[model samples]
Every structure is written in C-alpha cells, then in structure tokens.
Target chain A: MTLFQQILTIAICAIGTMTTRFLPFIVFFRGEETPKYIQYLGKALPGAIFGMLIVYCLKNVSVLTYSYGLPELIGIAVTAVLHIWKRKTLLSIAAGTAVYMLLIQFVF
Target chain B: MKIKALKAAFPHTIPILTAFAFLGMAYGLYTRVSGLGFVYPLMMSTAIFGGSLEFVTVTMLLSPFAPVQALLMALLIQARHMFYGIAMLDRYRGMGLKKYYLIFAMCDETFSINCTADIPEDVDRGWFYFFVSLLNQSYWVISAVTGNLLGGFIDLNIQGIDFVMTAMFVVIFLNQWFKEKRHLSSWIGLAVSVLCLIVFGPDSFLIPAMVCIIALLTFLRKPIEGGEDKV
Candidate 1:
C-alpha cells in the first residue's frame, strides 16, 4: 500500500471508531429527555460492562492448552483477594501483575 | 481546578501507565518490524487510539489496501465503545466542548476509570475525566513512538506484563461489585460472556456476549431495578 493509502486506512479506522464512541450520544441528544429505559441502561450497564471487559482481556486464554490458564487464574485470584482484603486498587493490581509475570516467566 | 483534577486523576491512571507502556511499546516494535517507519505508529496511535484496533491496523497496513475491510473491522472491534457512550451519556453531559474529546478518548481504560472512579466532591468531574483520558492517551502515544524508535535496543523480560490490564479490570470489577447492592448485572456479564466465548470462540464472541448481556439485563430489569432479591 502506498503511504497515502496507509494514512487513509488509518483514517478510515479512526472514523469507524469515532462513530461507535459518538453514536450513543448522538442518538440520545441532551436536548430531549433520555428515555426511562435508556436511563436505566445508563445506570445498570456499567457493572456488566466492566465484567465484559475483564472477559475481553482474557478472551484469548485457552484453558485447554499448556499452562491451562493457571497463570491468568492465579493472577485474577490474587487481584480479587487483595482487593477484597485490603481495598487498595493500585496495590491489588500491581501485586497481582507481578505475581502473574513471575508465574508465566518462571513457574508456569 | 484543572491541576487539582489532574492530581486526582493521575493516581487512578497509574496501572494504565504501566500497562500502556509495555503494550504500546510492543505495538511500536511490531510496527517497526513490520517494515513500517516510526511515522506509522505515531499516526496510527494518535488517530486510532484503540490499542487492539491499532495492532490490527498494522497487519491491515501490510495487507492489500482495502479501506472498506479496515473500516468494518474497526467498527466490529470497537462496537463495545457504543456501550460506553450509552453508559456515559448523562455523566458526560454539561461539560461543554470537552465532552467531544472525552468521548473521542474513551478507550477501555479511560472509560473504566471515568465510569467507576469515586471523584471527590470538590474536584471538578469534567476536568478529572478529561485528565484521565488525556493522560492515558499520552502514555500510549509516547510509548508507541518510543518503542518504534528504540525497537532494537529495549530488550526486557516483560512476558506477562500484559496481564496488568486483566488485573486492573478484575480490580475494577470487584470495586463495582462491592458498590452495588445486587450482583445480578455483574453475574450476567460474566456468565454470558463465558458462555459466548465457549460457544463462539474468542474472536467472535464479544458482540454476541454483548447482545446477550443487554437482552438478559433488559429482560430482568424488573428485579434488578426494583431492588428485589431475585439474584
């Protein structure tokens, strides 16, 4: 691909992405009242969205393969346990990541 | 106000700082090795700030220049952002012109932090969200450029550093779980996603998972919203 085409391709991606990000706001403009259903969604979706995101991050992990996803499993366990025990977000994440790195790098 | 918001926002983005550094550098290195110049990573990282899509764009760039395919791939991968936009519609209102940038920069990490971070009452919400988005994007763009420029010299044993992202999300999910009275939405999200992943596999399960989640949530809205113990 030519340099121009490459830039165009990137621009196309940018356009597509911006569309998804902006579509909801555009559809539910602020001038009119947002429907009750959408309002409920706006409140309720975050919890599920966060959950979906966690799964999205680990989508490629194969429990059937080598290491059996033990590294990811243990990593999540450490993160969840630390957060539940101490309630420090950064501490939980940093420690969990360190443990996972060690596991994948050596133990696994 | 902006300084205060930045100070408040910076701490929340620390994990993203770590995660993006590795991921962005890897992307830059990938771009460099893919026979592209630093310009590609720089442009793509800035224009297409979404991490996964940017990585895919590198491969797209190497292949035949099918603009339609690139656009469709981007829309498919990024369709989740629509959910973010829906969730953030009210939260992002009344921010004037800054809302545009906020929506534009609402990648996964930014959206996660902005959606869940308990901003103090005195701190300005708009600026706080803005700084989080700005800081996250800065980390990504800078790391991508650095990786592309120094692709050959920076050898580090960071095999599982990517797990920081997963770890961060897990923590965020836990935080949300603790905040809510009911775990119905959270459980639905997890179960439906796992089911979809098993059924459709990873590459194609996300949209289905999202559809099923919305459907289930909509179906059970009575119990979820009525504050009844239906879980």
Candidate 2:
C-alpha cells in the first residue's frame, strides 16, 4: 500500500473503533432519561463483562496443545488464592504473573 | 482536584504499565519486521489504541488496500466496546467534554479499571477516569514507539510476562465476584464465553459470546432484578 493508503487504512480503523465506542453514548445522550432496558443493562452488564474479559485474555490458550495451559491455570490459581487471602490487588497480580513467568520460562 | 484524582488513579494502572510495555513493544517489533516504518506503529497505536485490532491492522496494512474491509473488520473486532459503553452510560454522564475522550479511549483495560475502580469520594470521578485512560494509552503509545526503534535489538528472558494481563483480569473478575450478591451474571458470562469459544473458536467467538450474553441477560432480567436468587 502507498503511504497515503496506509494512513487511510489506519484512519479507517480509528473511525471504525470510535464508532463502536461512541454509538451507545450518542444514542443514550445525557440529560435525557436513559431507557429502562439500557439502564438495567448498565447496572447488570459489568459483572458479566468482567467474566468475559477473563475468558478473552485466555482465549488463545489451547488445552490440547503441549503443556496444556497448565501455566495459565496455575497462575490464575495463585492469583485467586492470594487475592482472596489478602485482598491486595497489586500483590495478587504481581505474584500470579511472577509464578506464570517462572513456570513457562523453566517448568514448562 | 485533578492532581488528587491522578494520584488515586495511578495505582490502579500499575499492572497495565507492565502489561502494555511488553505487549505494545511486541506490537511495535512486529510492525517493524513487517517492513513498515516506525511511524506506522506509532500512529496506529496512538490513533487506534485498541490492542487486538491494532495488531490485526498491521496485517491489513500489509495486504491489499481494502478500506471497506479494514473498516468492517475493525468495527467487528471492536464491537465489544459497545458493551463497555452501555455499562458506562450512567457513570460517564454529566462530565462535560471529558466524557468524549473517556468513551474514545475505552479499551478493555481502561474500561475495566474505570468501571471497577473504587474512586474515593473526595477525588473527582471524571479526573480519575481521565488519568487512568490517559496513562494507559500513554504506556501503549510510548512502548510501541520504543519497540519500533529498538526493533529486535533487545532480547529479554521475560517470555511469560504477558500473563500479567491475564492475571490482572482474573483478579478483577474475582473482585467483581466477591462484591456481587448474586453470581448468575458472572456464571453466564463465563459459561457462555467458554462455550462459544469452543464452538466457534477464538477468532470468531467474541461476537457470538456477546450476543448470547446479552440475550441470556435479557431473558433472565425478571429473575435477576427481582432478587429471587440470593445465592
């Protein structure tokens, strides 16, 4: 692609992305009462979204492949356990990532 | 007020700092190796700001110049942001012009932290969200540029460090789980996502998972709102 074409492609992507991000807000514009259904969604969707995000992060992990996602599973276990035990967000994330790094770098 | 909010928001973004540094650099390196100049990754990272789509965009840029296809692919890949927009509708309201940037910068990480972070009452909510979004994007943009410049010259033994993103999401999911009284939504989200992933494969699973999630949630709205399931 030419330089102009390349820039256009990136611009197209930017527009496409901003469209999805901004559409809902434009439809539900402020100061006007949000729809009952949308309001319900605003209250209910975050929990589900968080769950989906976890799965999204691990979407590429193939259990049938070599090592079998063990590193990821163990990492999550450490994270959950540490978070539940201490409730320190940073600590849990750091320790879990550290364990995963060690596992893949050495154990796996 | 802005300074206070920035301080409060900084800690929440620390994990993103580490995760984005690696991921963004990897993206930059990929772009550089793709025969593109550093400007491509730098501009794409700054303008697009969505990680997955930006990575895909590199390939799209390498291919034929299909603007329509690029645009559609971008919209489809980013459809999930609409969910974040819906969830944030109320929270982002009345913030004046800042709301525009918040929505524009609402990548998965930014949305996750902004939606979930417990901002102190004394701090300004708008500024808190602003700084989190700004800081996260800055990490991504700067790292992308650095990676493009370094271009395979540096090799670190941090192979699995990308797991920080997964770890962060897991912790966030667990936090949400502990906070909510009912687990149905969380269960639906997890179960449906896994099922769709298996059925459709990772590449195309998200939209299906999202569709199923919304449909299931709408179907169960009555029971969910009625507070019938206390478990």
Candidate 3:
C-alpha cells in the first residue's frame, strides 16, 4: 500500500471508531427526561462489561494444549497469590506476565 | 489555568498511558515489519482506538483487506462501543457542546476513570472530566505516533505480546476484587465464565456467560449490598 492509501485507510477507520463512540450524543433525545433505553443500558451495562472483560482476558485459554494452557494456569496462579498477598495491580501484572512469558519460552 | 487540568488529569492516566505506549509500540513494530511505512501506526492509533480492533486490523492489513471489509470488521470488533455510548447518555448530557467529544473518547479506561471517581462537592467536574478524557486520548495518539516513527529504526523481538493486555486486566480485576466491599458480582463473573468455558467450548460460551452473569448479578444485587451505595 502507498502512503496515500495507508493515510486514507486510517482516516476512514478513525471516523468510524469515533462515530461509534459518539452516536448517542449525535442522536440527541431532545427531551427533558432520560430515555428508557438509556436507563436500561445504565442498569445493565456495567455488569455485562465486567463479565465480557473476564471472558476477553481468558479468550485464548485451552485445556488440551500446552501452547496457551499452561501459561494461563501459571498466570492465574500468580495473579491469585499476588492479589491475596500483596494487593498491587502493577506488581501482580508484572509477576503474572513474567511467569507466563518464561513458561512460554522455557517450560511446557 | 489549563495546566491545572493537565496535572489533575495526568496522574490518573499513568497506567493507561503506559499500557497504550507499549501496545502502540508493538503495533508500530508490526506496521514496519509488515512493509508499511511509519505513518500507518500513527494514523491507525489516531483513528481506530479500539483495543481488540487494532489487533484484528493488523491481520486484515497484512492481507490488505478491502475498505468495506475493514469498516465492517471495525464495527464488529467494537460492537460494544454502541453499548458504551448508550450507558453514558445521562452522564454526558450535561456536557452541552462538548458532549460529542465525550462520546468519542470514552473507551474502557476513560469509562472506568469517569465511573470510579467521587466527584467533589464544589469542583469543576465538567472541566476535570473533560481534561481527563482528553488526556487519555492524547496519550494514545502521542504514543502511537512516536512508536510508529521509532519503529523505522528499532528492530527487536516482540513475542509474548498479547499478554500485556491480559496482565493488565488480571491486575485490574484483582485490584477491583480485593477492594470490593461486596465481591458477589465479580465472583459470579469469574465462576460463570469458567463454567461456561468448560461446558460450551471456547467458541460459543462467552456471550452466554456474559448474559448469565448479568442476570445473576441483577437478581443477587439487593441481598449482596443490603441496600447501600457502594460505588
């Protein structure tokens, strides 16, 4: 792809992505009251997001293979222990990521 | 005067900035390695700010997919953004003219930052929130552009990449879990997802688990909270 083509592609994608985020604001309610659907989404969205995030993180997990499985096990273990013992996000993430990478490179 | 906003906004944004910077670097490295020029990563970061979407876009780009395909793929991967906007309607209504920008910038990090903070009694929450929102977007844009530019010269191994996101999620999840006055919903989420993964196979179980988790949380919330505003 040429420079111009790449530039165009990025522009189109940026517009689309921003539009998705801004759709509700653009299509204003124009009424004083909060819309029913928005209210429903407010009630429902947070828990759903939290759930989706978990599934998202574990998206690559598989039970049969050592390729992704063992590393995930190690990650979960390290996360659980760090969470209980130290309760620091950056530390826990670093520890888990280090374990996962080491396992992926070294261990089965 | 605006510097106050930047200072107020930047501290809360370090975690997000760090994550975006490294991930942006990875994407830029991928861009150069895939035979595209430096501008591609910068432009993509500025444009397609979605986390999963950018990763997916790389594969599509390697194949050099058609424009329509890229558009549809962006929509599908970020289908959740529609919901994110819907939930923000009431909160954003007060932004007046800046409402549209709020919608554009509200990613997972932005939403979490918006939702978690206890807006002080007399503070200019509008400005504070706006600055934070803008700061998040700026961090992403700057990191991506810098990474892409740097990608032109640097050559290094970039394996174990996806786990950066995973590690952050696990860390955030753990942080939320420990501090949660009531851990019922998170525990439900964790258990339900694992069970669904075991039962339905990885391909089909996720959405169902999400739905079930929502249902369970809604029904169980009253008892769990004992009628108090936790967040």
**CA lDDT of each prediction against the hidden true structure:** 0.85, 0.83, 0.63
The candidate 3 chain B region of ten consecutive residues with least summed lDDT is B156-165
Task: Choose the strongest candidate by lDDT.
Answer: 1
TM-score of every candidate: 0.67, 0.66, 0.63
- Locate the minimum summed-lDDT window of 10 residues in model 1 chain B: B156-165
What's the CA error at residue B88 for candidate 3, in Å?
A: 7.9
In Å, residue A39's CA in model 2 sits off its true spot by 1.5
Tens digits of per-residue lDDT for model 3, B58-116: 54565553576556545534555766676666777677766666777777788878767
Candidate with better lDDT, 2 vs 3: 2
Order of the predicted models by lDDT, top scorer first = 1, 2, 3
Provide the lDDT at A39 for model 3.
47
Fraction of native Cα contacts reproduced by each candidate: 0.80, 0.75, 0.40
lDDT of 2 by residue, A1-108 (tens): 898999899999999999989988888665466578866775567678667768877888989999899999999999999999999877897899889989998999
lDDT of 3 at B32: 60
lDDT of 3 at B95: 70
Q: Tell me the tens digit of each residue's lDDT in model 1 across B1-231.
A: 999999999999999998888778767876877778888889988888998678768767877788876776688567768878878988999999999999999998999999999999999999999999999999999999998888656686656766766786788789879878888888998899899989998667766887788899899999889863344
RMSD of each: 5.8, 5.9, 6.0
